[model samples]
Target: MAANILTDPGLMPELRRVDHGFFGPDSVAWRVWTHPSILIGLQRAVAVQFLNPFFTAAHDDAQAIYKYPGHFYDMTLGFLLSGILGDSRTALQTSDFIMRIHTRATGIEPISGRRYHANNPETQLFTHIDGWQSMLKCYEVFGPGPLSPADDHRFWNECATAAELFTCKPDDIPRSRDGVREYYATLRPQLCVTEAALSGMRQLLATSGPNSTAKLAAFSRFATPATLITLPSWMRRLIGFDQPAAVDRAYLPFMRGLLGTLNKSKRATRTTVRLAAPISGRILRQHWAAGTPRRAEVATVAEARKLYRQELRDENGFSSDTEYTAAH
Candidate 1:
């Protein structure tokens, strides 16, 4: 995408050996993230992300997505995949790459004249939490049904761990469903749809495979409403994504059937990879290529960070961002 953005850091060998980089293989994060249906949540999360006028304003000013939509998605998906599935080094570096990009995304909101920076902890926190919530909620609804209460708690706690990559303190993130609801409650009053945000939302929903083939176009058609229906009715209405209540009711069964059949066929994950390749392929494809190792060391995010900390030292002779790699 961006000329400075290095999609591959040549860490797949290490990534392949990592039994558990940050979240363990046994983690609720892995259980939820590995599902093909998580794409629905990711799509809807982008819509919700645009609801924050400031956040939308920052992105609108940057226009990175507008300039290079295909590369933009590829990088987004890459960051998500590497952070979730990569080794400590890969995950940490990918997070840094994203934050570095954010540092340049700054502008003043047109409506309130308030300054906005993508690196702001508040905006980053909203994005982090919304994405986790959307993916898990979508999985519960469309994929395998609800998780155990204990597992849900674990998932949210793991979300906090992942927040280390963002400007937010991991401790400030919610660790339970009730906590998340309360977190959003405080922000709800601050959120409103703006014309710019509405346009951005529509554009994000319209994304398709790079080829724009018929099948992919049809999938995009189905996916837009599918993601819209997953939003809370209030959110849907507020964002102008509301559908007829009857359509909402009817689509649920159809989606459940479609996603269920795919999951059962064991082709869902592979299909997701293929579909994502055109627009956003490298990171996910790399992760898929790495595959799961049967035996290797597992480490907590903190532990893994410490393990890789020395690897990133500038004195260690790594180049600047363009060629930085965990491999030495």
Candidate 2:
């Protein structure tokens, strides 16, 4: 049967509410959960980090860039897909969307004088680089399947051509500083075309029925776990869960609900979970590993669910157990 949620737009708002409750205000996590643009940028960054093992090796610098902006986008993509598909199309469409945005944002078109403060040159520039890097990574993975090598080369050429126009020294590319009107002007056309293309592509893909369904299913896996882990740390801490145990306590039910949902959803096929399990495990093990004291405190899946239900009783709130077991 077709999923009830596949065509529902109202669900987006509920997803946002869940996200807000998990991330909280004043935390860096809000930027990604609330903003589509920032979230796209982050997905691009994760694509880059995933493809380029160098970033993984350079963990400290990578974490610094990723924590605020990069992590936000990663979580956003994960959340969006989690709410939509889970892990079915993990990086495919997301990478495509981000690349399309990058292609337009960094192109040579002029920006209209009346744009938001956030759409200034610096933001566009940083987003451009992040997008280009991500697109390259996507090209490395899925691009080769549907696109010709010539197409890949041409795309990279366009990206390089755009990058050169806005840079001075080879390494000193202009980025979002304070008020970057000129940069925005340059990016306007590319951004417009890119967005249009993305819309068209989304529509076309959406109509493809089974393929679209499978892709979205793949995406959901990546989305759910990342949201369960990342958001609560920031939100609960903001809500006064200073102790690691308290923070973990607050996050238990949410995680269990998340995992249980994944286990039950029609989208949660073997391919989806199998593909996602390694990525999820790696992210959890990496962040929650012993080196980082805060991250180190996160519990395993079994432990998290047990504790989550315990806290549900303490708060006198019904747990998602009914839903969880019903799915089984």
Q: Among these predicted structures, which one has the highest lDDT?
A: 1
| Candidate 1 residue runs with Cα over 4 Å from true position | 1-6, 9-14, 208-218, 265-267, 277-295, 313-328
Write down the TM-score for model 2.
0.24
| Model 1 / residue 253 / CA error / Å | 1.5
lDDT of model 2 at position 181: 38
55-95 in candidate 2: lDDT tens per residue? 22223222322233323333434433332221112112222
Instruction: For candidate 1, write residues 92-162 as lDDT tens digits.
Output: 76676666556657889887898988778888889999989998888888888999999988999889988
Best by TM-score: 1
lDDT of 2 at 152: 41
**Residue 293: error of model 1 in Å?**
5.7
**TM-score, per-candidate, Cα-based:** 0.85, 0.24
Query: Clashes in each model (backbone N, CA, C under 3 Å)?
Result: 1, 22
What lDDT score is found at residue 101 in candidate 1? 58
